[model samples]
Target: MKFFCATFAMVVTSATQAEVFTYECDTPPLSVWEVAGEWCSPLESLKNGLLIHQVDLCPGWPPPGGQFVFYTRSLADFDGAATFFVQWELQTNGDSSEFVGVCPASLSLGSFGPVFYQIVIARDTAKFHRDDGLPNIYISIAPDVPHTYRLELFGADLYTWYIDGMVVASGVPEGAYPSFYPAMNFGTRAWRLPNTTRWNYIRYGTIPLDAAGDYDSDGSVDEFDLSFFVECLLGEGVPSGPGCGFADFDADGDTDCDDWVAFQAHWTGPPAVPPIPPPCAVVGDTNCDGAVNVLDINAFVMALSDPSAYAIQFPNCPMSTADANGDGAIDILDINAFVALLQ
Candidate 1:
């Protein structure tokens, strides 16, 4: 019941024939689930329309081993600031790629400055952003501009570079950790540690899935956090004040006690919704808006090409303060909506 795909042409480098804007999929109707389990990306057959270089990701895009990368196995204390981001197209012919900030597998391939891989921000029960198993190695660079790197590792010994976001080239240059059998990279690579530089389409992983509610990635964990954990089990969502504690974990809240003892987590692989009650059913969400961007993809393509007899229910999420193409997916990269309103 869903087949929208048209523009797809990728050949960035078969030795530089350079066609870059890829996503034309459909090798012969191969991936067919059209609904439930959600496979669907055969590029939907191509009727000549898929050019979403607005960097699409709805039904399928970036689902390929990308996004959802979380790694922090070893770090006793580096504590700098470390950060992450991805999303491009500054008209992109390739906008001068060099982004590979966050390395630390133990610094060997030209290890320079800023390498902290420690994920123990723990506050535990209070949920201030729990991680506190304690040891410490954070990096956090956000100088903005064209370059920002963070390579580090000490549980084994490796470190690399970062400068505009600050950590200024702190190498250890010798190398280790990467050969786990091919790849699982963090800070994701298009090339930066040793230097290649198509730059970065985006890749990040350090490995942290103790239970995975993804904390609050907002990528998707529907039923609205089990409908806000059944509205915090029926009390109606409480526990706030700082970071990640909407239910203090499995007690009656959003999966927390290590995702509540880690049993039947979610994303069950089917039942994407629809017991029936959705005839375009959004019903004046008052302000909950879901997928419609650029302050709302041309306003839902001009509200479905207006003549608006009426179709309400879209509200929340339309107030981006110009985190500006920072590309972190706070709604498909907060698309600048040309930085103003519509005409």
Candidate 2:
């Protein structure tokens, strides 16, 4: 009944190039996972402008049995707003699966090519029920900041939604999680995403992982990694195999789910994972086995250069300590040290 959200703090990148804010949740006081973003884009269409309470989320996260929740207040698009919608992303690997959240969706009164926004109410919450039946959950953004957004989603015999900190809506869509119905997604086909919309005070809360390093997509890593690993044993992909980032928990160049196991082994508490050892005389016990091995060593390497990538490699590993050389926690200095060891 009592769950903690991911502790996140926004990292306002650059106002000139959009930014992402982060805050940590479930740290003790208020374990609410929250991240905010103010950017244009990051990847191809997935700009680095990831919102807070959601931006820094682990890709292909929540594994299978896991659950996740993010809140975006300011979501703006590039091309003229014609009516935008976000996809749940059924499968980042190849399925390109997706769904839409339309109820709380928005409509713009202003005119802006690349802009959108929303705000999180104080007493907003999502309640889960055992029954199957729910309405759409979405908020309508307007110049009026003092307004409220009500939302609800249905599974099958149950609905999930909260109103002003109350379970206004409850039930699961089709009696199954979105994972079960990869193709099912809500949308705002009725209204269009005008070229302009703004949001503010966005908040989020959730339990992202059942345990650390559960990147196998089955939720928990444990022995399941063997299955996801077997599936990608011979595969080769950056961070992840053909399945995207599900099994590449430790990014040790080996496609497997063991990464999730290692992450769970030393998570200190929270959705985070174990930490990869430093690059110096440091032990690469990233898996928290208290020894230096391929997993630790490889994860250590990723730590020096790419912190996020490093986290993905060894989810549980303390990526904060990735900086071996100490130039700046997991900076070029650490990379140099790691590479030196390779040479």
Candidate whose lDDT is highest: 2
The 10-residue segment with the lowest total lDDT in model 1: 121-130
What are the models' TM-scores? 0.18, 0.25
Tens digit per residue, CA lDDT, model 1, 66-114: 1211212111111121221111111112111222222211111111322
Query: How far is 98's C-alpha from truth in model 1 (Å)?
Result: 22
User: Per-residue CA lDDT of candidate 2, range 220-265, in tens?
Assistant: 3333233323334443343332222334556565543354345446
The local lDDT score (0 to 100) that residue 157 gets in candidate 2 is: 40
Query: Model 1 residue 113 lDDT?
Result: 28
